[model samples]
Target: MAINRILIANRGEIALRIHRAAHEMGIETVAVHSTADADAMHVRLADHAVCIGPPAAAESYLNHAAIISAAEVAGCDAIHPGYGFLSENARFAEKVEAHDIAWIGPKPEHIVTMGDKVQAKKTAGELGLPLVPGSDGAVSDPEEGRKIASEIGYPVIIKAASGGGGRGMKVCESEDKIESLMSQAGSEAKAAFGDATVYIEKYLGNPRHIEFQVFGDGNGNAIHLGERDCSLQRRHQKVLEEAPSPVISDEERERMGEVCAQAMRDMGYRGAGTIEFLWEDGEFYFIEMNTRLQVEHPVTEAITGVDLVREQIRIADGKPLSVAQKDLEFRGHAIECRINAEDPFTFAPSPGKVTYYHPAGGMHVRVDSGLYAGYSIPPYYDSMIAKLIVYGRDREGCIMRLRRALEEMVVEGVKTNIPLHRELLHQKDVLHGDYSIKWLEEWLESRED
Candidate 1:
């Protein structure tokens, strides 16, 4: 099915990203938006724009019927849910397919399988991926959990089976604390994800968050782009990302890249996906997989020179991957700082008018944003307003370029985390790329004391 026109079923920089790719591929785009986003950059730039509903996300962005209706009315041949809202919704993917419209994402079954943490871990292990040692599946029995904790050694983490974002996670260092922590984790999981099921895994004291970018044609063929180090996070939310991790060697990358690609091929996966791992002591442990394009994809793009969005559209059109494993090459180092509309230090959301906006500009600096001087950022969505990405020949050069870029960036009216990113670049640990997943939170804590 050739995708002549695509309905972009998302908002913000990602939607604009999709629109640019579709246009580059000679495919027209229809931008769907809430009333609040009618004046958005993507909406204004798209070939066609449709107002789905009101400002509230539930009444608009998450409204499946309204989106499908808009797609049909716009005569769109495909729907591209760009990394949020309904992007990973298996039911929504099925609904689009039922309507005879191409779904520019992973297959619905793959989404379903990977959406659940326990099932994803099971499948990853079956596909020959190394997993953190612990319980096989959801463990409800307190005594069973105790036994597993004792066997796996102490300091095991309890996590929700149905969701992530650190909501339903607890760490127990001793055997006596397993039952209480399990109950607490289960309660939190039930409240956050509507599922009380929780699983157990051996706790890694300090690990770097490493994820590989992979693409599949849904025909038992796949390729991995490389790995991104996302260890700089706050509350499990990524703050900055970089490609060709400062630590991973070329030999390790090749070894792990093949392992990841083979897993995708074994599953008959499709579209863009990320396989996340916790790296410690020179070994990688599988965590979970995101069956959709990630927020930190730009860094990978900068290093690999691959237009992921364009590849997604091509794969949806039943085309084979443009670049093969042998042809793929990692060129340089790239870093992306997620600039959010918030208090840089306190991390509080700040949504309002953009009094002034001057994004960083240079040869290797790319700013993905939808803000303008007079634009009003509505308070109804995610706080992230921009992504500042920079590339150079090496890690040191990348950081130097990124520092210069950050110095030039100016976003007024609404507060942003620009200062946080600037501070991070100055840290010795960050400069040496010797930080763990707990680095940011601890750094922030030290700032207060």
Candidate 2:
């Protein structure tokens, strides 16, 4: 069951992150990259490199057959689909398993259950997990959507059954906007998931983005790895995240954690997963379950010292968890800021050659960067260039490290969110850890100063 040789089914920082961890454990890593990334840092850092296909995702990252063949040829025992592309693709997970290769993720069934929002909520309810009152199935009729909304009460959210990146969601304030919003939501969902089916759910008022990290050994053992605060977001995408949510009390944390762990067990989930929730008025409502290692796992690693991907590989290989829930300890706070290659003000991708790249480094300052000096920032995939993770004794101390990191970070010839992060740290509410989901957008607009 030892994953001595692994094929990283991804690129960029995540690939390099997995590569470093594997090397530390004396594991050999084979990095798979697109044509554009043949000379990328991940390729150079891996023990071996393979070019899957062209630059586009469909031909490269999402091509399951190609990836499996590459792994087989390389004599790899496992494949780690870091974050995006086929990470959450249930079909891809199944294909990997068919080849007798360890799929470093939850079971394919778990992915399908969570991929569809309506089915996920129903499953949660069946497992005695908290759920915001909503429809049991997709509403094909606008009238049906409104009727369900009336039962649940307004500010209802129309969501795509298979949506991501906050793309196919519409908030309806009243019955007047219900029809138009449903049409828009359905259209967006159809274009995105290839399934036009949409669902209705009650929207919580000013809720915080809270999620529990859990690990299942494909057996009866499932343990919660503490919670993370991801309330600082933009357009439903997280910008900043911290471990040990600042708002939740110890009692509340235990309750939420227990429920999430039990819920995952009820679904017969296997491997590493995240159960996201909307926490408001001290009540938790199931948001969705992420079926792979999350983009924010470094924060959890900083606090718990647990290598999540490593655990995932073992779990998939039918091995038991190394540590028990009671044996683990979260002794500190960690914060992560996503640095995207974009115009600070316009938020548009600014892809080009990196004139200079200086990553921040110091005590408790860990940076997972995908770019190096002169690395080309292609527009093919996400613009996220680096993740700056800072850890400290407390939240305030972590914030201080983030400030210093931002000040020291220097990426020339490419606009970044560094300047915006500087202004964000200075904001009174942000510094006090009392910001909402719209904190960044609203703050940006108010800078009419």
Candidate 3:
């Protein structure tokens, strides 16, 4: 069956992203928006729009019933969750498929399996990937966590099974701190994710975040595009991303890419996914697999020239992958800096009307945004307002182009982190690519401004 119309169960940039991809392929789109987002760009651009609910996400974007109903009423044959809200929610995926609407992402089973930390680790290990030594299952008590820590060596990391963005994670340097940290982690996990289950892993003090973009047709055929270095982050959230990791060698990329492709095929995975790893001391340790499109996917798209959203729609329409591994080629270096509506130094939200907006534009520069002059950034959503992406013949050239783009960009009324990004780009360590996941936080602390 082919999907002629898809309902976008999302808002802002990602919803617009999906709309663009679907329409480019001559497909129609239905956009669902909350009261706060009634005038959102996605709704304004889509062929059909529906008001789901109020500003509160629980009653709107996260409300499965409302989204599904909107899809049905709008005559959509498929629904695209667009990376957040219910994007990785297994039950949501199942419900969409059960209603006879194609889920334009990985299968529901894949979502459920990979959403659990312990299960995801086991699955990745079974796929022949190197895993960081840790607990084989969920550890609810301190004794069990301590035992796992002892077996894996000290300085272990306690994590929530449903953790994300660095929440419900604690570093225990010794057994003395295990019990307290375990209880804290569990409590946080329960409150944050509605599940108290926690797990443990060997903690690497300094590691680079690398992920490979993979796709599958659910018929044992899959391929990997390449790797993206997402080491520059704050509090486990990526602020900047680049493709063709500066640290990985050509041989390493080939080996890791093959492992990712084969693993997807073995798992019978379908649609776009990212296999993340922690690279430390020349070794890649499997972290977890993101079963949905990542927020940083634009950098990968810029380098590979693959429209991943379009690929997801095609795969959902029961089409096989149009390109093979050999057919894919990395063209140039690409970088994306997440432009956020916040106080750059304090990192506090700066939500209000955007009095003025001027996005950067030039050869090899692209800005993916859902904002314009007079647009009000709702406090109800993520702080990110746009993604500034740039491509060049090489990494150095990409940096130069990105610098120019950042300077040309301007957003007024609400403060933005553009200044922070500009300053970071000028730093010697960042320019030299001599940093890890921890580097961004430490750099922020060191800033006297």
Candidate 4:
């Protein structure tokens, strides 16, 4: 059941990341790219490359038939859908399995269950996981949403069942605004996910965003890889992530880790996944479960010394996990900053030719980037250009090292968010590890005045 060759159904750094891991494991990689990404680093580094379609993602990256055709033509045994695009698509997973090709991720059923917010909460509750108080299903009517909000208290968040990355969500602080917010949420969800269904959930003010990394071997055996603090976010999208959450105690970590591992086993989940939670008042409330490898996975690898991509391939091949819970141990702290090709102040996309690119390098400093000098960043997809990961003996050391590494790094010709990251590192709250999901947006707003 070993996979000898894999087709990367993605582009950019994550595609390159998968290729590097596969190469180290003696596996061949076939990179699939759009016409605009013909010169992408991942495509160049792969053992083989195929042009799936034109510049538009709908005709290229999101076209399952084209991707399957490419994989079959390349004689690949598996497909690795990196984060975004088709990563969490259950139908795509089922289609891959139908084509007799391994999908290096969770089962199709698992993806369907977790991709929907309401269903995910139900499953979590069935697994004995705590959930935020709200409607048990999609609220089809405004009156229903208002009623649920009354029971859950004010400041309720309306979320799309299939939403992620901060889209299709709205917060309503009073009954007066419930109807309008619900309509907006449903419309946004319909446009973004092709589903107008929305759900209501109690919003925790200033709660910290924490997520546990879980791995399963598809035989009901799983283990947790500690937790990561991703409270520094903008519009529900995580900007920075750190392993060994600075706020949680050892006792809390062990308790939460065990719960997440048991939940995975109960769900019969396979492959690598992330169980996100909102931590407030020393309690945990289940958020949605990410059915595929996360963008912030590098920080987990940095602290645990595990090659997650390698593990994903093995797990997809029906192999058992290499280490048991008792054998796993967390090491030093690690931090990751997402470097995006955007206007630092306006957060608008600034895609163009990267005339100069110099990545920082030092002990415990890792840069996972697909961009190179003279590489043109296409304006057709996500703005993230690279991930800067740094590790140290402790949180303080990790922060210091990350700051220095960011300082050493350089990219030219396209505006980047490096300036924003630099300002974040120097902030008193961030330096003290005292921030929540709402903290960054508020801080960003304060910068304007």
Candidate 5:
């Protein structure tokens, strides 16, 4: 069934992104937003709009019934839940499918299998992907946890099976701290996800966070676009991302890309997904797989010259992939800076009316934002206000262009992390692309001192 109109069950830049893609494909869009987002850019641009609920995400975005009702009322035949919110909710996908609406994402069962950290690791192992040595499943006994930590050596990490964003995680350097850390992780997990099941993994001391973007047609065909380096992070949240990691060679990319694509093909997966890995000393260890369009997907698109959102809609409509593995080519280096509405130094949220707004513009520079002069940023949602993506023929050229673009960007009335990004570009390690997952935090700490 062709999707005539899609309900963008999201807000902010991502919703606007989907609206643009759908419109480009000659399909109309319905923007379902909370009352606070009534004046949002996406809602203003969409063919139709609906106010679902109040400011709270639980009462609006996460309210599956309200979203479904909004879609039905708006005459939408498909629903696109952009990254975050209900994007990876397996039951929510099932509900949408049950309501006879096309879900522009991965299969419901695949989402369920990849959503659980323990189960995802097991599946990765079965798919012949290398995994970090750790417990086979959830560790309920302190004695067993100690045994696993000992065998895996010291510096093991306890993680929630159903958690992300560094919430239910603890890294213990010795066996003596295993029991306490496990209990703490379990308690944090329960408080965060309502699931206390925690798993253990060998802690990587200093590894680059690399992830491969993949797409499937839900039949047996799948292909990988390439890898993104997301090592520049703070408190487990990515601040910036780049495609075609500086460390990976063309041969390495082909080898790993084919491996990832084959894994998705074997599973008969559908839509877009990212397989995240930790790279250290030339070895790749699987961490987890996000079963939805990632926030940093624009970097991949810029490098590959593929419209991921368009491909997602086509795939959901039972169409085959537009490009095969051989036809796809990596042309240039692309970097994306996640601009947040927060204090650059202290990282405190600064949500308010924008007195003035200007985004950078030039060759190969793209800014995905919803901010305008008089629009007020609601404090109830994510702090990210824009994504500045720039591309170049090479990494060095990319950095040079990105530096210039940063200088051109201006957001007034509210504090923004633009200053932080400017400072980051001047760092020696960042310039040489010689950093790990711990680099940004260490750099931030040094700045404070």
Candidate 6:
């Protein structure tokens, strides 16, 4: 596989992440930057770098034309959209493929199928995979949503057919709420997705967020790397992520992974992807699929010792999975805390220059950051500055290590969610791994009370 040079179509930590991996794999890397990121850490470290556009992402990272042009100008053979921006865009994937440049991710069809929530669910259901009872496709009217909700039982979730990260979701408990919820959800989806199509599903109350990591080749074989527990979240945005959910039984873990791999195979899934689920009342429901590397992929890598980026390249080159299910072994525990540049209490964005910087370091501690001393946190991008990943023999040990790492971290100029993470780690419920998706929000509300 001549995966010699790669152009990273992203910014921040993910760009730095792929750069580090490619460096170790003997692959040259070019970092694409915006005007605000000329002196950014990723740009400074790459073998070659170029400014793709202005500060705003819509004209920069999301601008597929500029990224492909950058790759061509730099003579890069492949484009790796690390995570956000055009990472999961089917049109972008097709555009890169049209240039005869390798897209270091899943196929465009996989991206399209998985990117649409209702279509993904229908496909999964066809494969006999367990899915949450919901509308088969996008619903045009509130009456259709009401019919589906009635059939699926009450307390259903109204979500945008083409949405994610909780941007266009509303939970309606009664038929009365469905009218208002449907109108609101449709409006939000129209604004967010440019498609007013909405869908309904029975909402699982107090469910745990778990997802399986699956990788595949274009030839159709794939295997799972196990599961990650992302139950600790706020506004459906993951706050902390850990591998091998502490609450899941071994049997349940195997069951989920096996079915997820099968589902991917049936869908002709290739490259890195994630199958998200909500487990409650001893049942697992395949919710939606992400046809790209996840933001929380590092925790899985820490436990499996697999460089997913390298695997993505090998698969894209038409090589089958080298590791079989029988050969894979997961050891230890890993946890990731997103160190965002924001207020710990208010949870608002805090964008400014870093006056001072001191990142944590110790055995089994990995800090993936794109910020440095005097680097400004531009208001145009995501507020996350670093991902503090820690691995240990077990979850308990990992917790202690995280506490130590949090104590050692010092971002002097800007406030961060470090205090919130500190308090969350010490909570008995979170410590015991008994929290749910709503735990963080409820915990904060109770703290206020």
Would you estimate the TM-scores of all the predictions?
Answer: 0.99, 0.97, 0.98, 0.98, 0.99, 0.97
User: Which has the better lDDT: candidate 1, or candidate 6?
Assistant: 1
Question: lDDT (CA) for every model shown?
Answer: 0.95, 0.87, 0.93, 0.93, 0.96, 0.88
Query: How far in Å is the alpha carbon of 260 misplaced in model 6?
Result: 0.8
lDDT for 27 (candidate 6): 88
- CA shift of 230, model 3, Å: 0.7
Question: Candidate 3's residue-wise lDDT over 139-251, tens digit each?
Answer: 98788877889989989998999968788999999999999999999889889989888899999989999999999998899999999999999988899999989999989
Deviating ranges (above 4 Å) for candidate 1: none
Cα TM-score of candidate 6:
0.97
lDDT of 6 at 401: 97
Q: In model 6, which range of ten residues has the least summed lDDT? A: 313-322
lDDT of 5 by residue, 1-449 (tens): 99999999899999999999999999999999899999999999999999999999999999999999999998888999999999999999999999999999999999999999999999999998889999999998999999999998888999999979999999999878888999999999999999999988899999999999999999989999999999999999999999989999999899999999999999999999999999999999999999999999999999989999999999998899999999999999999999999999899999999999999999999999999999999999999999999999999999999999999999999999999999999999999999999999999999989
Which structure is stronger by lDDT: 2 or 5? 5
lDDT of 2 at 192: 84
On TM-score, the stronger of 2 and 5 is 5
Please say which candidate is ahead in TM-score: 2 or 3.
Answer: 3
Tens digits of per-residue lDDT for model 6, 1-449:
46678999998999999898889888899999999899888899999998989998999999988999999999988999988899989999999989989889988987887788888888888876788888888877878878888899999999898877787789999987888898899899989889877888888989999899998776667789999999999888899999979888878878778888887777777899998889887888888888889989999999999888778867766677768887888899999999999999898899998999999999999999987889998989898999999999999999999999999988978888988888889999988999888888999999899
List, residue by residue over 220-241, the lDDT tens digit for candidate 1: 9999999999999999999999
RMSD of each: 0.7, 1.4, 1.0, 1.2, 0.7, 1.3
Quote the positional error of residue 343 for candidate 4 in Å: 1.3
| Pairs in clash, predicted candidate 5 | none
Backbone Cα, N, C clashes tallied per candidate = 0, 0, 0, 0, 0, 0
Cα error of candidate 3 at position 374, Å: 0.9
Q: Which whole-number lDDT from 0 to 100 does residue 48 have in model 2? A: 89
